[model samples]
Target: MRLLILGGTVFLGRAVARLARASGHHVTCAARGVSGEPVAGARFVQVDRDHPAGLSALDGERFDAVVDVTRRPSHARHAVAALADRVGHWSYVSTCSVYADNATPGQRADTAKLTVPAPVEVDNPVGEHADFYGPCKVSCEDAVRDGVGPERAFICRAGLIVGPEDPSDRFPYWVARLARGGEVLAPGTPDDRVQLVDVDDLAQWLLYAAENGLAGTFDGMSAALSRSRFLAEVAAGVGRPDPELTWVEQDFLLARDVRPWTGERSLPLWLPLPEYGGFLARDVTDSLAAGLRIRPIAQTAARTLEWIRASPGDVKAGGLEPAQEAEVLREWAARQ
Candidate 1:
């Protein structure tokens, strides 16, 4: 099927575009000539995705599916409105952050919390500060649903999406820190629950939904496990010392108000994972029920570390000096 993906040059967007093409689907990607070049074998549209008006370039272009990974809902609302009548399916990349609850896990679309205070105009100005990021995306989701209905549109609300080309230093920070191999300055307890979806898995599942023209919103959780075990697996992946939890106690960091990872390591596990500014969100029952699942959590995190080890440059971009990292590796090894 012919698929048009907006904002398909970076991060989650890039991953989705690549995965779709690899699966033998015709993929057309659009971005503002920023961050990436066109992927081989896929059509690339170099237009400013932030500008809803730019979308007019594709006025009557027909496609079987459209994948929107843009953060601004206004642009999405505009593009969808323009193309909704022509497209067979709309796969929106929503976030689990829309849920304002943290008390428990297993969040479904029918959950009590509805993402209120929806953005008034989905095609508002370009800057993110005023546009829909999380709450804004919630509004966009509603607009898409209203315009196309559930049967024609699918929302893939994802948890922490981690893997290669991860710009946010959140997950990579752990990989780099663990690669250092010493007493890693880790926050929170091992028992603290952690969840992150691998990029490949998320992109693949998206194609699965799009291909079948599946309706309804779905949560996207790759795997869930305690933080400590999470670190252990990462250690194995990078050939680094397992992050020995200094066990500084969550209270110590809390007392000092150390808000690393946007309190992802310490916040009530079920609440949206905010470290990546709400990218790695939580409680995605809808995502799972909609048929988006993943490999084991241990392997997922391990694969992340393994990937980082293969590419030292990527991790460095996510953190500070390489020399300091060497020192860290030394400490981690000496202890073992």
Candidate 2:
């Protein structure tokens, strides 16, 4: 089968391109080659979908399956317009963020309401992390569905895709931090739910879906696990005994101005809002039934740690700094 991966230089895109190549599919990765190089064994096409030249480069190309991991709705619309006529199946790697309700756990793909839709022609100039990310994805999904119709369109609403080569430090932060072997500051309840899909696993499943002609939306994530269990699994993957964890209350962290999810002072993989209670606990029953398989959490953690060790400089930007964590712990202890 001939495969085309849009934005195939980093993380999920790289995973799919490399895996598809190994599986004997003739693969082509189209990207600007700025973030990272395309996976080896796949043909490379330099196309910045934001520019007219990028769209022109794909004018004569054709493929059996096209996996688009674009964040910008405008880019998604452009790619659809360029390749819809030639491609056999269109797979858009969307996010769980597209859902309107993070408060409700176990909502199916069709049952959940989506966020505000963005205009297909409007580019997210503020960048991928802007507040418009989810809303724009709603539009992006629509663009693909509208372009190719539901029969040939595949939409994967993914959640917290983690594993080696992950650019986002959300899960990697815990893998590296807990590996240091100390009293780590944990956030929220011990039994708070968490779920993530390994990038390689997601990649494989995506290719499988496209190959099998499975169309329509599905939640691409694993079943939820307790937060404490998640941390312990990370420790085990790091080849260490369970490290001491100082479970901090959500209110305490909130009062001290500690943020959730990303940034330097934030605790990764935690959200205190009732609205987000189900963010990490999204239902993947349909995904799993449709051949979405997740690897063991420990294996994902170990591989992520291996990547961090290999690239120490890239590992420093995520999670709370040591001094900041210690300060928060000290204040918590004083209050006690």
Per-residue error (Å), model 2, residue 47: 1.4
lDDT of 1 by residue, 83-131 (tens): 8998988989887767766444554556538556454544442465553
Candidate 2 overall lDDT versus native:
0.87
What are the lDDT scores of the predictions, listed in order? 0.68, 0.87
Per-model TM against the reference = 0.81, 0.96
Point out where model 1 deviates above 4 Å: 49-52, 119-132, 262-286, 297-336
lDDT of 2 by residue, 1-336 (tens): 999889788889999988998889998888888889887798988877877446687788778999998878778888888889999998999999898888988788978888889754456826544777888888889889999899999999999989888878698889988888877899988989998999999999989988999999999999999998999888898887678999889999999988899877889888886869879887788889999988888899899889998987765476788999999999988989
Give stretches of model 2 more than 4 Å off: 119-121, 125-129
| Counted clashes in each candidate structure | 14, 0
